[model samples]
Target: MKYEQLANDILTHIGGRENVASLTHCITRLRFQLKDDSIVDKDKVKNIDGVVSCVNKGGQFQVVIGTHVEDVYHAVCKVGKIEADSSGEPSGEKKGLISAFFDTIAGIFVPIIGALAGAGMLKAILSLATTFNWVSPESQTYTILFMVSDIAFYYMPFFLAVSAAKKFKTNTFLALIFAGMLVHPTLIGLKDAGDAVALLGIPMRMATYTSSVIPIILIVYFQSYIERFAKKITPQAVKTFLVPIITILIVAPVGLLALGPIGAFVGEYVAAFFNLLNEKASWVVPTLVGALNPLLVMTGMHYSVGAAQAVQRATVGYATIYSPGALASNMSQAAAVFAVSIKSKKKDITALASSCAATAICGITEPALYGVTLKLKRPLYATMLAGGIAGFYAGIMGVKAYSAGTSTIFTLPIYIGQDNSFIHACITAGIAIVLGFVFSYLFHKDEEAAPVEEEVPAGKTNVELNRNQSEVYAPIKGEVVALENVKDDAFSTMAMGKGIAIEPTEGIVYAPFDGKVEVLFKTKHAIGLRSNEGVELLIHIGIDTVKLEGKHFEALVSVHDTIKQGQELIRFNISEIKQAGYDCITPIIITNTGDYLDVIESDKSNVGLDNTILTAIK
Candidate 1:
């Protein structure tokens, strides 16, 4: 795989697998929380073939991987053997409680945000459909869709339980059970009752827990402590049943009586305080939120506000301050990207700006904020200034969202029909977009990414520049398959350019086209070939087999050696490779793919040595 070497190099420079505490990825970067960030070789990582750059932000060792990060993320994780959420518990270089708190909350919520966004979209679409009467309110479609969308929110505790348990390093099953007890049907019936329900003669306070946030978090956090304590006292002979029995017996009622009410109380008071500020000084909330939004996102403290938003929605239907300012900030960021796209003359810079603009409009601002605005500096100033102005306008208009979801264009329907606020919200959003564009265009000077003097820019694995057809002979006799269907995303996504992978029947690797050997890996598992037509090619022997250090392979030629089509390049012992437990599906790739218009793989299921397996279109 093209990314195999890159992954190995990245893992090595990031202090190896042992130094990594946890690994996660956003759209453009691989966010690694390391056991020690001091050991990272940042310059070395930046210079790696596929890596874009590195940043130390929000206590994360962020290695920018561009659009093909998914491929590299999986490759790194696969080689590193990191499972989902398999981070070590918080202990290392000491961080304050505040940093740890925000980090934990963001970590738990970020993974489930996609599901949350999808549910929000469903709700928004349902509202729009019913508003216009396109779908009958009494119909099964509406009923089913409504329930599907509402289930996530109605049982927020259950979802939070699973995530919080993971963060707390406790039992997920027991956490789910704890959340279940709070929202149990029997408990709901006694919500209005003046008397407390007796659980084994202990008077337990009755509280409604559906859609509750803080209660379950508190329960799970304390559950970790209680479960450990119970296990310590219980004997190994009866530990399985008795430990859970005693832990639940203690935590269940105590949670319902003490932790449950206390957590919910905190949520209520927080909402009350915000509502209080909203009435007294309306502009303060929006202006501050808008100005600090990009900063909040950068540090992952935005999710703290997200938690508060959820709390406000559950306690009071609709949220006013957060949604309005968040929308303004997001749209303003989009407008800044649009401004940058319009001002830049370079195709690559313009293309990057255009893509970031799309994501920004969809209510995801990280791409625009990090990839474009913050990097350029002036666009960021424009965004912050324009965002505050727009936020002031939206806040004054008293715009609020009735449904609980991010303020994406898709979820705008939720803002409609709330005290005839649709027109106001729409107009306010338009102003934000226009003003953002104007301000950014004025403040930001035209700028472009650094120009490249090479045929294909360095750090780009491949580029597709032209499509003049050229035959690529088969390098090995094997079963031919489409490149897009390859198991590795790097090859399939054309991130490593384009070509096809083969399930080889033989171990010999032949020269596919007449060229000089540009470079050969020290491990003898891969080689780079540059054809006379300037088509750069890579032939990787197998997935992650480079760690073998040339054990089962032999190279027939060295770097700069003149090679002809059908000439033998390398020979491997297939049986020995398989005995070492590695898949030997070889991948042939065009590394300068971006310079070509397209690299087309053969349609045939099978091919012989030196037969045409691909056609590179210039």
Candidate 2:
């Protein structure tokens, strides 16, 4: 509801799209990497119609929109024209080395993770059927299901090639050609060769590319550079044939000789690193993952582990390190939401809690995360703490899944038909739910308490004439015009109630015969007041000054303060507002226009804070 206004308000409060380098969202928040952080008004953003909260951390501007974050994110993207990461590509402008590295990982992994999840779930089902003796291992049905589930992983290089091509902006077919070489039969057969194979008289090492991760990515990255250079050197007439030719010629040998081996080694090292952690400090894996899974899910970097863990499972018999923590984390989140559902009496909160609980139980945690547990803030703490405990238990019990898939009730079959690990998995989930519910139910009731209302002191204009007629003075010195002429649709269309607009000659706003300051935005770019004669007004300083984030403004008064005509309401600097590229056309409107029968406007061409801008008539 009111998504357009929410989008507009969000865009404005975050310093406009020009200030944004790029944008992304987790389950609940719009993560914006802004060009200038100092220009954002965090408080004003939190007060926007749809926003739940605002946070500035790790060089990102976060706007929490709860469950509908995706909708708002798309709306913001549409308004901003950001080439976002449904492609899972890092769409931000230049970032520091570390940020870029993480961004790249998220981009490359996000697009493929869904496919990975689907295949993993399929494998889990196949495992279940075979375990139950419903399908024989040698049967055609089992073979086909196995093929569908394993093919993606067996040929992960090809899929990664497509995604990496989009990220690096290279010729996709060229990248595929490069991936083809890595998994070619000759290369596979070369693994059994007694000696190194020669390519163009250069010695090349033999390695398995099936179920591989990094090698193709490296080759494709190099291929993109070669393709880019080839298009530049070759004639446009012969570009089509020449580009692929040059790319293959350059990428093939170097990939075989250097990058492929390096990437393969890197993948091995990554897997070995986790294995080392598992052996030396088994509990650390579960503890760290359980504590940070929610955060990892938000940045979308959790999928990065799939590649490394795939290598682990292929090299070893099963994936042990990552799955335990995932199961615990999911169960704990579900339990937390369920606890909160019954604790609250509010229908909306209860409905959200119930739905999210069901979602988490099925292994999809986004709903529980954004709509219920995290929304309340306290339940998240319970989930995290409980998850850590459950994960530690899973580690101690050596819980393992034959294959890595999402942690949900549906995935329980993956843990079954293995050694006693299935029993341990059940125990871990049970502990997670029990601990999560108890702690959350115990500590989360404070947020459900009824809010106390605050009374506004007298002195706000209530002296209604026979027609409830009142004179509203101008808030700023500027040219006066009808509200419909204002640039913003919310004001121009009178959706925010009828008002007059001004193209101010000065930056300071004076109280327009103010009886009380009903509202004043912390950003100081806007103010609301009730004049001594019962005229209510909403004075917005600029067309989108909300974007300037109070950079050029300062509040001179606070809410509920009584004031006289010509009293200074705010002080602002137009230079920064102008530099930031916002129109400083302010709107002064009657918020309760329906209360009066006729609202008459002034015929004056230009006026200051002393001029009567509108006459509210009843």
Candidate 3:
């Protein structure tokens, strides 16, 4: 899979592997903890062959790679190295407050989401079996499935220990040992018996660490430092065996006797605090998350809320306010996509909106936000308003979730609790979706089409200039062909942005710009360039000429060569190219056209050497 190259490219693109503070992967994405999320080039990464999409979610820059994600992940690890996980030191200054906060929460929570979801589905299946009488709840099949459902929750500390170990740059196996000691049978037995045990005469109060969240995470954090110290002091010859032995002797007693119980108590108290909020100030949590979620999502701060929910679920068996509100928020965003699809005047926008909406409903929102709603502006506002309203109602109704999964409309059924308020909560969520759709539809107006002005602007005299501007001239000369005529949509419709085509009188090509040559296709059919003025151009020598390989072409300049305007770059054997039965269609495109607007092609039927074929307006 060329993992080394993939990792190098990703590291360089993300400003370097040193800039990453943490890393993890989900079902279809690699989540990066970058020092500065703003440095990520979403569009450039999306264009990479293996990447299906790129998103900033839960405070992580996620690159979606469909089913082959593991291949890409291995490639990333190969280039960055496995030890890169422990390199938590930021390569640069800290990110902004919101980004940092979100990153922290995402770091702590995203790793567990997959385990939790898998466990939840198992539990759901077990429930269905018991409900339908397919098997008695006490039967072997039921018991096995029950264990599968319960293991993820019961051994959550072990899972967290491993993930947190990676995040803190500690020994993952050692962290597991630390986790094991906390949840060991002897400790659980002693704690259940209400015994006050002394380890090395240091008095210890024990509590159940099974299903616990924060204690092991904190323990591993301390273990990272302890392990590093152990490695340094031990002789290199004995280091392999000495490091673990010394680290365990020093860390286990201290963690079990001190740190573990303290973290457990803190988690308990936090759970109690939230329970109090639910009992007395229930509406506040939902109201706040609902009101601010959209803004949080916009700046990528919403992952903190998800982290809080994970902590809440692990401690008290339920999460308050945020999960249901997140569900509503995502559904509202989906609704905005639908609204735009139905109401947008442009045919292209309508198609884009519909496709993005479907992707959002399936649990990805970048397409909906970046591709559609954010561009429209009004839809974004409507989504926020609807989310806030839903949150307020959910808080007042005391809506809660018992499991964690992707927050989306289809997952709404998970929120249906066995309580009277559950029905009302469901109704409120539905209303939010309707309100969001209607509001966005009513407020949004399509952007006004730019007025088309003729060349030479009505009656102005056309100036014939013999002088060449520093601007890149078109390599081929003919009537400008719109990008839509191209076969690939990624290149056509200027999704990669604008350029024109030229039908050549001869199969020879001239340099379009005064710049360093960047790429010469192996097939000898396409050339990419970066002009001195920072313009990027791709001159594809002939339509579908790639089929002929280099059979009918000869290059005059190699890549990296600095060539002047009107300099011969390639000589195409015109008669031979035609004899091979290929159209001599040439596309001279501004590959970086997104950086500029109003690229004007010269009004000419034919052009000669030194003629103005194209003009780029910055």
| Top-scoring candidate (TM-score) | 2
TM-score for model 1?
0.60
lDDT of 3 by residue, 318-342 (tens): 7784776776677777887889899
For 515-597, candidate 2 gives per-residue lDDT tens digits of 88877654567777887567778888876465454577878787766778899889888767878888888888887787888
- Assess candidate 2 and give its TM-score to the true structure: 0.65
Evaluate all candidate structures by whole-model CA lDDT and list the values in order. 0.79, 0.78, 0.72
Candidate 3: count the clashes.
2
* Per-model TM against the reference: 0.60, 0.65, 0.62
User: If ranked by TM-score, best first, what sequence of candidates would result?
Assistant: 2, 3, 1
By summed lDDT, which 10 consecutive residues of candidate 3 come out lowest?
A: 461-470
Query: Where is model 1 more than 4 Å wrong at Cα?
Result: 1-92, 138-140, 447-618
Query: How many backbone clashes can be found in candidate 2?
Result: 2
* lDDT measured at residue 223 in model 3 versus the true structure, 0 to 100: 91
